[model samples]
Structure formats: structure tokens, C-alpha cells
Target: MSDRAAAFHALHRPGRPLLLPNAWDHASAAALAACGHSAIGTTSLGVAAASGKPDAAGATQDENRDLARRLRELPVLLTVDVEGGFSDDPAAVADYVAELAALGVVGVNLEDGRPDGSLAPTELAAAKIAAVKAAVPGLFVNARTDAWWLGVPEPRDEALRRARAYREAGADGLFVPGAPDDAVGLLAAQAGRPLNVLHRPGGPGLAELGRLGVARVSTGSLLFRAALGAALDVADAVRAGREADLPDVPAYGWVQELTERFRTDGHR
Candidate 1:
């Protein structure tokens, strides 16, 4: 097994789903890495928002590539979310995956559903998966299905069908971001491949997911949104003069000092 791939796999404890926290930029990733996160992924939503582009629209290709380059030096394993491979062309998708793999990224998340609320053809998506495997060979492809997220009825059946296809097409794992709670565990069992899922705050806890045999649990954009929410909450609390519930935030100087330390130590 690839050290990177093996590192990611080792995170999948038998009774615990690997908690994959996603980061938006270098500072966010470096900070998370400093917290001892062994593996990290990127959220396309955060990346797209930071770059002022619409997510899952094939935009911000260069920006995402640049972020991968910046994260290449990090000590943790890195996974990038390449929305629909950033193009419908399988060759283009393979090229993009190759670029990321060259930067030491061990994994990539590729969605099959388009931004227009339509799903990419199964054959076409599978082709992209196969091409990525051929190009990188070691880049873990987490094939994501938007059957439920896109409002498709009969999500379970549809997700299973597409997931099986992706696995056969050489995807290392299957991600059903909006799969039903009842079906999520079932998918993990039936997929026969590693199940990488999005964690909803109020949804099944990680322990429940591990019991269900989920191999990986991703905080897909949840942490990013939570950060935004926390900022808003703190501002509102300050305006209301509620000093007690300020969330015990760290001082700016502390964050700044960490920045200096990061630079001085050159630790990724």
C-alpha cells in the first residue's frame, strides 16, 4: 500500500469512522495540521466561496490546483475535492488528477452530479474514474453521488447503482453526501468498498457511523459553515453585551504567534 494511502486507511478504525476535517486555505490547513490531524481534505464549497466562484461549476480549477500545491508540504495526507473533475472531458479530469498526485495528494473527491441539477451520464463518470486511476494509479478517488442531494427520488437504489458502478470503475471509495440516514449504514455495508460520508451536525454521530461500518466521515463544508456561524454568534453576543458566552475564543496574538512559529519551524 502507498504510505499515503495506507496512512488514510489506517485512520479507518474498525469501530470508528475516520473524521476527515476539511480546510479552506493554507492557514486553515496548517492550523488543523498543527492540531495533530493526520489526514485532511478540501471542501469545494469553501474553495469556491473564497475565490468568489460558484462551486461544482468547473470554476476555480487553477485556484484549486494552487491550493493543492500549497498543501503539498503539509505533514498530513491530503485529499482534494475536484468538482466533477472540473470538466466533462475524461482526459481533462485525468490530467487534473495527475497534477494533484504529483503534488503528493493521496486522494481526490469527484462528484458525478452537475451544478445544473443534472447527473452526469454514468458511463461518462465511470470513464473519468477509470482515467484518473490510469493517470495517477495511486490517487484515491472518492466518487461522490448527488442522487439525494440533487433531489432525486428513490435515492437509495439510485445511489447504490451509481456507487457500484464507480467502484467497478476503479474508485477507491464511495461518497454519498446526502444519503438517507436509514440507507447510509446500508450503503456502507452493501458498497463492499469504503464509504466516505458527509457528517451533518444533527445526524448520526460518528460512533453510530462506525457501528454501521462507515470507513470515513468527512466534515464537508460543515466546519467552514460552522466557523462562519460562530463569528456571527460572537458578534451578536458582543452587541448584546453577553460577555460570558463569547465562546472562549483565542486571542489574535496567539494566532499571530503561531503564524510566526510556523514560519520559523518550516513545519508543514
Candidate 2:
């Protein structure tokens, strides 16, 4: 396996989950890297919105690749969120993932959520995972099922069934984004791979998640949304003659230094 891929794989320790923060652009990713995060994943929503496209609508294919190419230059491991692999054809999905692998992306989150708020057929989703694994054996594939999020009947059963199929198809991780706290352990016990749950505000904390046997906790779009909220809050505070409640705000030069470092440190 590629060293980066191996490193990323090793981070998924059950009961000692890796807290992965997702980023939208280079600056956001760089800031997280500078803060000592060992790895970062892209948020599909942030990437799509930044380019004025709808996420998971089969758009943003080029945008996702371009961002991955730039983010690969950061001093951290990179995993890309490729919604439905940007295509329904398994071969096409594998091709996209292979291109990403060649660009130094060590991991990918491929979901089965359709644009109409429905889960893709289990067989089709599993086939895509199999094709991606076949094409890029070293890349860590995190197969996500949106059963819980889409309000499917017997969401846990649906999620577990898909998770098993994905695991058999060689997925390295299983992600159930909207899984509830009570169901975490049951899912983790049967996922047969790393269990990745999306972290939410007022939900189970990282420590609590870790205790529930989750191997990964992804801040899927949460960080990007929080950043947006902070920006607007600061702007509103300035207009209202009130001090912003923001904390850990980086200075201009510190931000500028990141780009310089990426350039001079052989990112290109």
C-alpha cells in the first residue's frame, strides 16, 4: 500500500476514533493542518456552494478534482468526499477515484444517497465500492449509507445490510451519517470495518463516541458551516458596534504565510 494510504488506514482505531475535520478550500484546509491536524477531508457541500453548483446533483466533478489537486499540496493526509462518485456508472466512479488516487488522495467517502433523498440500490452501491477497490487497492474507501438521514424504514437494518455488502466489496470503512447515539454500538459491532459517524452539535462528544466503539468521527460540513456562521457573526458584530465572540482568529500574515509555505515547500 502507499505510505499515505497506510497512514490513513492506521488512524482508524476502534474505541479511539479519529476526529476528522472537513474543509472546503485550500485556506481552510491549510489552517487546520497548521493547527496540527494530521488529516483533512473535503466537504462536498462547501465545495459545491463555493462554485455555485448543487452538491450531489451530479455536478462539481471538475471542482472536486481541482480542489483535491490543490489540497494534496498541504502537509496533511487528504480524503475526498465524492458524492456518488459523481456518476452512476461504477466504471466511471472508479475512473474518478483512480484519478484522485494518482493525485495523492489517500481516502474517499462515496455515499449512496440520491439527489431525490433516496438510497441508491444496494447492489449498485456495492458494485461501485468493488470497482473503486479494484482500481485503487491502496486507497481507503469509506462507503456511506444515508438510510438514517433519508428516513428510510428500518434505517438501522438498511444501514447494516448496506454496510455488510460494502465490507464484502472491500470497503475499508463504513459511514452512517445520521446514526443515532443509541445505535452507535450495535452498528459498530457489525460494520466489520471502521465505523464512521458524522459528528453533530449537542450530540455525543468524541469521547462518548469513542466509548461507543466508533472508529472515526467526521465533522461533515459542520466545520465549514461553523466557519460561515463565525464570519457572518463577526460582520454583524462590526455593524452593530459590538465585540465579536470569535476566538482563535488567525492574523493576516499568518494566513498569507500558508500560501507562501505551500509554494516554497515544494507543493507544486
Candidate 3:
């Protein structure tokens, strides 16, 4: 495995889960790295929305690739979220992930959720995971099942089935977003791989998730949505002639320094 890949894999300790924050663009990623985030992931919704396109419909392939290219220059590990691998064909999915690996990306999150809110066939998802691993063995593949996210009937049973299938097919980790807190330990114990859960506000924090045997906790699109909400809140406050109740807003120069350091040193 490459050094970056090894480092990323090492971060997924069962009792010390990695709190991975997802970023949308270069500024957000660099700023996160500046704040000492050793790894950063791209948010598909944020990428698509920023470009005025719909997310999870394979509309952000180019946008995702561009952002991945830009983020490779930062001093942090990167993992791109290729929704449904951007295609149904396993070979095509493998090729797309191989490209990201070539660009120095250490990991990727490939989900089974379709644009129509239906889950992909378990065999197809497993095929994609197997194909990706065969193409790039060193790249960490976080195989995501949307059973819970899609509100399917008996989600826990379906998630467990898919998780086992995915792991058997060479998935390095299992990501079941929107998993209920009580069921987390069950999934983690039986998934036979590192369990990754999405961070829900007002839900269990990182320490609690670690205790539940989760190896990775991703923010997913929460950060992006929160950022948009914060921007709108500031705008509304200013329009109403009220002081913006911003919290620890980054200075303009500080933001500029992120770009400046990249320009001068080529990386943080």
C-alpha cells in the first residue's frame, strides 16, 4: 500500500474512530487541513449544488474530479465520494476510481443508493467493490449501503446482509448512513469490517461512536448544509439591520493565506 493509503487505513481504529470532515472545494479543504485535519473527503451534494447541478444523479463527475485534483495539492489525505461510481457498469466504476487513485486519492466512498431513492442490487454493489479493489488494491474502499438512508423495510436486516456481502467482496469498510444509535454496535460487531456512520447533530458524539465499535465517523453533507445555513443566517441578519451573530468567522486575510500558502509553497 502507498504511504498515504496506509496512513488513512491506520486511522480507522475501532475504539478511536476517525472523525472525518467532508469538504466541498479547495478553500474548505485547505482550511480544514490548515486546522490540522489529516484527512478530508468531498461532499457530493456540496459539489453538485455549488455548480447548480443535482447531486447523486451522476451529474458531478467532472466537478468531483476537478475538486479531487485541486485537493491533491494539500497536505492531507483525500477521499472522493463517487455516487454510484458514476455508472452502473462495474468496469466503468473501477476505471473511474482508478483515475482517482492515480491522482493520489487514498480512499473513496461508493454508495449503493440510486438517484431514484432505490437501493442497487446487493450483487451489483458487491461487484463494484470487488472491481474497485482489483483495480486499485491499495485504495481504501468504503462500501456504503443505503438501506437505512432509503428507509427500506427491515433496514437493519438488509444492511447486515449487504455489509457482509460487501466485505466478502473486498470492501475495506462498511458505511451505513442514518443507522440508528442502538443498532450501531450490532452492525459494527457483525459487519466483519470497520463500520462507518454519518454524524448526526444532537446524536451520539465521536467518543460514544468509538465505544460502539465504529471505526470511522463521517460528517457527510452535514458540514456543507450547515455552511449554507450559516451564510443565509448572516445574510438575513444583515438585511434586518441586526448584527450578524457569527461564531468564530475566519478572517479575510486568513482565508487569503490559505491560497497564498498554496501558491508559494505548493502545499501547506
lDDT string, candidate 2, 74-97, tens digits? 889999999999888999999999
Instruction: Please give the lDDT score at residue 29 for candidate 2.
Output: 91
RMSD to native for every prediction? 2.2, 1.5, 1.6
lDDT of 3 at 145: 91
Model 1 stretches with alpha carbons more than 4 Å out? 13-15, 239-244, 261-268
lDDT of predicted model 2: 0.92
In candidate 1, where is summed lDDT lowest over 10 consecutive residues? 259-268
- The number of clashing residue pairs in each candidate reads 1, 0, 0
**Which pairs clash in the backbone of model 3?**
none
Q: Give the worst 10-residue stretch by lDDT in candidate 2.
A: 259-268
The superposed Cα distance between candidate 3 and the true structure at residue 262, in angstroms, equals 1.9
Model 3 stretches with alpha carbons more than 4 Å out: 264-268
TM per candidate comes to 0.92, 0.96, 0.97
Task: Judging by TM-score, tell me the better candidate of 1 and 3.
Answer: 3
- lDDT-superior candidate, 1 or 2: 2
